[model samples]
Target: MKYSLASGLQPPFTQRESFVRSHPDLYWRNKGIAAYEQNRATDAITAFRRAARYADKPSQAMIAQMLWVGDGVPMDRVMGYVWADLAAERGYPAFIATREKFWHELDRDEQRQAVVVGQAVFDEYGDEVAKKREDKALLLARRQITGSRTGHVGALIVSLRLPNGDFETVDGALYYADKYWKPEQYWEWQDSLFEKLPEGKVEVGPLQMPPKR
Candidate 1:
């Protein structure tokens, strides 16, 4: 089916004034969208990617859409999934449902690549969220940063015998405990899984929120 950027599936980023003003490539993208509607697949794919190189959010989502449906280019399942996933992460609700549908359609190999991407983003950012909540800062980081949770299985627990003194694996994915850590101790392992306890106390969630005014 032909997809329209004007449809409800279209996101808001494309409407940003700066997005249109700053991207010279958008001309080609607009042309390509028109061409695709007219059944010009090859031209549309070429134009879409050209636009996407400088695209902020909406354009990226549209490119992913084109790839997802094999509209303008040969269907590359892995790339398509990644692009669509990215779009969804950026608050593109339309991408959420479609990306999920495409995920299930992928072969085993394609699914595995998605898993790797999933693990990397989660492991690196999960602790950050926990830290923010712990600080009890008034401002909340946009959920966009934590959006990656939508993907699949996180990292595994290796052995707690590495040189780092923390049984962590950098090979596949990194999954630290969801809990917090206490101050230093010899054998007192904090909330984390490591060779030794953390050097200082690391709290997750609002460990110290001052009393309300």
Candidate 2:
């Protein structure tokens, strides 16, 4: 049930629709993750902040992760510690590892405070993390779009132009042999897609299609 971009599954749960049905916090949490993965820090912060409002223990732990490194949000080491401790109290493996990983950063007092709050949150939301994982898996499965091209050659040419300090249009669409269709980040994405693309009659991943000769 692990959800990953490589799996080629579209998110099963509709963010907008499901958000209305489930707890607002959970919806925002998922949104935050999506934004973060897409490299949208500002959007991620907004979603993570909202998730904090009604967060169970697992959600709080994720919030702590966001705070600690500013991964997709602002930096707040102390807050991170607090959330991590809460996760550890519930015996969450990742939180426990993180706490130990950063043990030396905090003083005795901060550590003690984290332990106190963490235990309480853990008691309340330990099981929620499992549910969250399930939710993520469902989302991934739902997102699977048949014939949805993650890699397209023409769009990639535009993307390649932009990355190496070249000027290009904001529109992602590209023209190869005078046919235009779709938008893309650049050719590097395409190159990457070609190199790592699964082997097939036509493998597609990082470098599926080389530039026209």
Residues 1-213, candidate 1, lDDT per residue (tens digit)? 233343333223333332233233345567666666677777766676555443323444566666666654777677677766654553334445556767888999889987777554334222333223322221111112223433232453323344335443322132222111111220122111111223565332211111212
Q: Judge candidate 2 against the unseen true structure and give its global Cα lDDT, from 0 to 1.
A: 0.46
Candidate 2 lDDT by residue in tens digits, 9-80 = 222222234222334544677776677667776786667655644433344555666677776567877767
lDDT of each: 0.44, 0.46
How accurate locally is residue 123 in candidate 2, as Cα lDDT from 0 to 100? 48
- Give residue 68's lDDT in candidate 1 (0 to 100): 65
Model 1 residue 27 lDDT score: 52
TM-score of 2: 0.40
TM-score of 1: 0.42
For all predictions, the C-alpha RMSD in Å is 22.1, 15.6
